[model samples]
Target: MPPKGKQATKGQKQIQEENQSTLKFYMYIIFGINAAYLVLQYIFFYDSFTALYIILFLWAVGVNFGSYKFMSSMASKGIDLNMEAGMAEHAKDVILVTCIVQSISLISNYFWLLWLLVPGRAFYLLWVNILAPWIFAEAPEVDEKKQKKMERKMRRH
Candidate 1:
């Protein structure tokens, strides 16, 4: 690493920018492919579940995106949120797998059951995100007397 007084070299900055740009391009491509699959689902099978699948696809993407933003913000604050981030990533994987399985379920039985997990995960993420503020709340400070009284009460118990 460079000394504290020195900024990153121009070459390092350029490399970092190029890497981020490449990563962003790849991410967009993957998302586009998923969207294309949903479009094909609509074209080939125009039914009630078709729209539901589309909505769920968008919802899953939104949840994952929100999780990414949340983790980035937490990291900026010097906090680690690895578990929450992992769940978000796992939820995305589960949804994608469910989509693929549901598509193939047309020929076979039982694959539709996997679709249940998508909404379940969505609800789980919704509940957790809604409660995120309280999850990180700091405890109120107690004056010395109150702290001693609480400690005494704990000992008495």
Candidate 2:
């Protein structure tokens, strides 16, 4: 058999690949929604092509591309790089922070801003990029015995 360390590393690599694929899948869905919104806006509200709308669209595209690049680079980094040990908790913090920031932006609309200061597209990108690393990080490996036990229990249910 291959060396034990090599096997563990291979498993971790596989997990990272899976995580990256999941992130990419979600990114594509987000991009599709954004594109659909832009098309619908152009069709139903031709007059809505104001400076704010243009800026928002451009910004959304930039952020989406940037986030994709960032995630790809992060995924390709050495597996032992300085990932937060407590990634699950960090993921929760990221979500909470994104929500708070978005809330502030939304509340700012009361000041009569012509368009939303923080468009949903921007927040979506932020959320994806911020959470991706943690979501993809390899979890501590379970023992084979425990795994088989769990599998047997699952099969019984």
Candidate 3:
């Protein structure tokens, strides 16, 4: 390492701070919404396992969002080490959401599946709408190049 650079510029620092704050704001909104939903589930469903699952979902959401928010905040303050952990939490959140939905659908006698069709469509939504695109950020670009390379190599071979 050549003594490291001078780090982020002022504008970059400001943008980073803004991003962190926004992330935290989003996290708070998510946490509050989940919390309220849990409360309502308890009130309406009266402590059933569904309500319990809802509560667990809320906790998982909070952990995931809060972890990312905290990581962004740390990065704004010039700490980059925690960002990986935050990303891991976000990935975990995605998996947890799908797992919870699938498990609940199965355990609830396929009632939620009726909301979809057949069963386990929630996994499709979670994976396609969220995880697949997000997890492989470089997949699209890599795929185009890979296809071209494969075509050229096949022609040569």
| Top candidate when judged by TM-score against the true structure | 2
TM-score of each: 0.36, 0.44, 0.37
Ranked candidates, highest TM-score first: 2, 3, 1
Q: Rank the candidates by lDDT, best first.
A: 1, 3, 2
Estimate every model's Cα lDDT from 0 to 1: 0.56, 0.53, 0.55
lDDT of 1 at 87: 42
Extract clashing residue pairs from model 2: none
lDDT of 2 by residue, 1-157 (tens): 5665543334677758665664566466556656675676678667756786566556545655555555555567633222455333333233333333323332342332322433554567667877776788899999999999999999999
How good is model 3 by TM-score?
A: 0.37
lDDT of each residue in 32-124, candidate 1, tens digit only: 655665666667656644566666556546654554455344434444322346543453365356546545654443665676776787778
What is model 3's C-alpha RMSD?
A: 12.3
Clashing pairs in 1: none
Query: For every candidate structure, what is the RMSD over all alpha carbons to the true structure, in angstroms?
Result: 9.3, 16.9, 12.3
